[model samples]
Target chain A: MTVKELRETVKSLLTEGKVDLVIGWGKGTMPGTSTPVFIDTAEKADSLIFDSTCRNNLSVYFTKDRRALAKDDKKIGVLVKGCDSRSLVLNITEKQIDREKVTIIGVPCNGVVDMKKVVGKVDGKEILEFTDDSKKVTVKGREFELTFPLDEVISDSCLTCVRRDAVEYDLFIGEAREPGSDENAYAEVEEFEKLDSEERWERMKQEYSACIRCYACRNVCPSCYCNVCFVDQNDPQWIGKSPEITDTMIFHIIRNLHVAGRCVECGACERACPMDIKLLLLNRKVAKEVRDRFGSITGTGLENKPAMADFKEDENQDFIMG
Target chain B: MIRIEKERIDEFIRALMETWSVYAPARDGKNTLFAPVEDPAGIDHGIFNTDKSPKEIFFPHSEVLFEFEGGEIKKVERDARPIAVWGLRGCDARSLRLLDKVFGSAWQKPDNDMFEDPYWKEKYDDSIIFGTACNEPRSTCFCNWFGAGPHDGAGMDVKVVDTGEAFILDPVSEKGKKYIGSLKGWAEATKKDVTKMKAAAKEADKAMGEVFGMDGIQEKMADLFLKPVWNDIGAKCVNCGACAFICSTCHCFDVQDEGKKGKKGKRIRIWDTCMFPIFTMEASGHNPRDMSKDRLRQRFMHKFSYFINNYDEHLCTGCGRCVIVCPVNLDIREVVREVMACEA
Candidate 1:
């Protein structure tokens, strides 16, 4: 199996002292989930697995625990999906992590399943097991078996992903699979943009109201690694602490703007949210706008400078009243 | 005891709404949540439990306490109409009683009137809890581990059990008996109907076996403050507050004043979690629980050891919402097992 091959590679890396810790995905507590596991010894490498349920972007650990690992003069290895590798590139460009002190083990993915959609399908039945094959996903419950099309249950970002292979990796497992859907990646945002100003504002308001201020979206994103978030600052409270409608709106709007040109569209924020808010749509919307204005795509390779960090001599400023 | 035919639920809810504003589990798209309903037809009663807890009906996520203008402060008026909460399970109903210990008695606390919170009292004191017995508990449910079961009636005014075709309303409190007795056109429950409810509840209890052994857990965790088990348990935690927010009994809050300069302000109480870095931050820029490991230690210690010292009851109701909604899949049941294995 491919998981065994991946485990053997990680074991050799740990045994050869190439890296001190290997961060990967492990069997989760639920049927259709995977948890991030940190393994420091070769013996624990077997606990790692890569599957459709391995949805977490392990690159978030680069912002955390990387400093301590570097202080000890040890390299750390991280597993990355096609989308997760983009955030790692962003982290490298932002200088949060030294590229020399880390190893990236990328894995080509065939679109992870959106757990909310699966759970919604099996509404009242107790799910006993779940298996994801290429074309079909079977969810076996206590008294029933349900098979759903794989494309229908995948995360929305995965549906239109053009990058199926890693942008940067020392070693990659499995061959790149075909893109699930050929639709335009920005089709949803374009449809949203066609709405009137009132409709757009109302849609944003409804999305923000469902927020519980849990900060899961902020904490889970690899790009959002600020020491003190804007919401937590009390010196001059920028946003209200309460989950009031206006406060929620301002928090989300500012958060999305902060990661405007930097977001990698990994859909980690959307996946991490317990409220099931469609947060990636906003990030994708901002990414589209940034590309339209700057003629650049974020985190494609190491040579490309970030759109926000660089400027052209004759930049177009027609929208800015120049 | 009164028997309500399954078909008469809408009529009963319509009658109940005449006196009290009724809140029940209703379908909101694919998710089920406790929402205010004018008509009972909107209620989704076939589900085992709602995705969100019923605690929000009384203790809202955010609420205004008072308004200040110039030099004067005015307290927010309490809702005059009473509330009837339907579809509360055993764990959720018991969570209310657990919350009452902290917010219930104000007259006899260390500080008399200043610390007394009237907001929780106004909504919770007059509210009636109609707890439904779980006939088919979900796989994530663990209410049985806390010395409660699918049909335990520790804190409910009225205990309801589904008999497949009818609902047997067993009044466990004086308020429940008075309300059910005064209602017209409901048939009295027979002995045969009572037996059916008991048999169904027993089957449910058996289905959800004990996931974690609760015996001696408090003592096992009492003095292991400096042990390495905490590090192992806290390592995988992403420090997201989804566990605390979805929890039925987590009641931490932060009071803040929102206003403009030379403008009116509103003082509101917002739901806060101990998992956040700023929760224990001192005014002098020093944080005692500075690391994620420290914050994770405090969460388990407070639930198992400190709360047992103060309240003599564990704070967790074992609804398992946290287990299900965790982004990184950190299971508290595993935390309990790890704590139980710790050596003194």
Candidate 2:
């Protein structure tokens, strides 16, 4: 299998002293789940596995300070899916980690199954095994076998994925496909646009009301690595700590604005949310606006500057008030 | 004991709603959560447990203590609505007992001068908890280690056993007995129904294997504060607070004053987690637990050691929500086993 071959490659890198650790996905305690694995030795590489369940962006670990890895200044190898590679590209451009200090093992992804959707569809059955071929997902439970078309169980971000090929990589594991068409990328936003301002505000209020302020969305996003988040600041106290409706709304708006031109639409924020708040709507709306106004697509290439970072004198001013 | 027919469950809920604000495990989008429900049909039937624990009913995510205007403080009135929380699992119900110690549930003015969480006491005082027995526990459930089981009743007033066609409701306290006796349309449980409930409870116990023992874990944790096991255990943690928010027993909170235009303001209390970097930040910017390793150590240490010293019981209830919702899959059971294996 391609995953096994990839494991062997990572194992060799560790044994050869090329990389101190290979960050990848490991078998989770439950079926249809995968956890981030940090393998520092060739013997530990056998636990690594890559499949549709490998939804985590392992590049986030590379950006964090590592005492052991930094003690000897050894190179770190990280496994990146299609969407996760974008974070690596952004990190390289931002100089969060030197490109020379990391080895990227890029893997072609066929989209991952959304755990929320699977849990909903399984109808309280203990999923024994889950296999996905991009087009369909087969779930085997105690006494029943069920198959769901990819459109039903696939993550929302995967469905609207425009970039499926690895843009930057040290080695490509599977067959690389060109960036697929995302004609319906903003279909949900378009439908949301049909609503009036009052309707939109009401919808946002209802969604934000359920937020418990766990900050999982911020912690999971690869771009949000501020040492002191605005929400955590006490001097100015920009946002309230309470879960008030208005406070929650402002928190989401400010957080989305912070990552405006940088969000890669990986759906990590929405997936990480315990309340199932449909947070991607806010991120995608900002993404769509940035795309239409500035003609900037984030993480597309390292050479391309961030939309909010670089500005032209002749920037569009049609929406500016007189 | 009273028996409620499967079809008349709604009738019981509707009757309770007339007297109290009834909350039940109901469908919220795709996940089941404890929400206020008017119709009994809205209650989730097949779900094992709510995604969010019923603890939120007593201890809300945010609550206003008082409002201040022009330096004059005005205390907010507590809601007098007596709440009825239905469909709580035994693990979740037991967690309330642990939280009671932290929130000063035993405090009285003459007896103890310690601060009392009136907000929690107000909601939890007149509240009635209906605990449901888990016949088919999830693989993530490990309550057997914390002196709790799938069918163990610790803080619940009533114990409910789902018998496929009907429910055998057994009162666990005087309040439960009084409440069940006052309710109408519920028949008295028979000998056959009692036997079925016992069998179900026995099956639940067997399903939850006692694979990991916590016999000396609390004492071991007390001595392993300076050990290297914490460094290894905290390595992969992303420092996300999902584990704390989902935990049934975690009860740390932060209070803040929110004012607008410098005229009127309100002081509110919200949930906080020890996993955050700023949870222990001093006003002088001196943080003792600045590193993620220290924060991770505090989380595990407080649950196993500090709480034991204060309350004589471990703070953790072993509901396994932390094991399930963790993004990086850091299992508390594994962490405890490592602590137990640590050489003192």
Considering every candidate listed, which one attains the maximal lDDT? 1
Query: Could you give candidate 2's per-residue lDDT for residues A196-227 as a string of tens digits?
Result: 99999999988888787888888778878777
Model 1 C-alpha lDDT per residue in residues B1-344, reported as the tens digit of each score? 89888999898889888888889988764456789987799888876667777777777888888899987889888658888889888889888887877777523456444344567778777778899998887778888788888889878999998897888899988889888888888899999998898789789888896657777667778677778888778877778788888788888888888785546998888889999988998999999988787888888877887777777789888788898888888888888888887786
Question: In order, what lDDT does every prediction score?
Answer: 0.82, 0.81
Provide fnat values for all models in the order shown: 0.65, 0.46
Model 2 residue A56 lDDT score: 82
Q: What is the Cα-based lDDT of residue A183 in candidate 1?
A: 43
Model 1's chain A TM-score stands at 0.94
TM-score of chain B of 2: 0.95
Q: Give the number of the best model, judged by DockQ.
A: 1
- What TM-score number comes out for model 2? 0.93
What candidate 1 gets wrong by more than 4 Å, as runs, is A64-67, A70-72, A176-183, A314-316, B29-31, B106-116, B260-263
Task: Give TM-scores for every candidate, taking all chains together and pairing residue i with residue i.
Answer: 0.95, 0.93
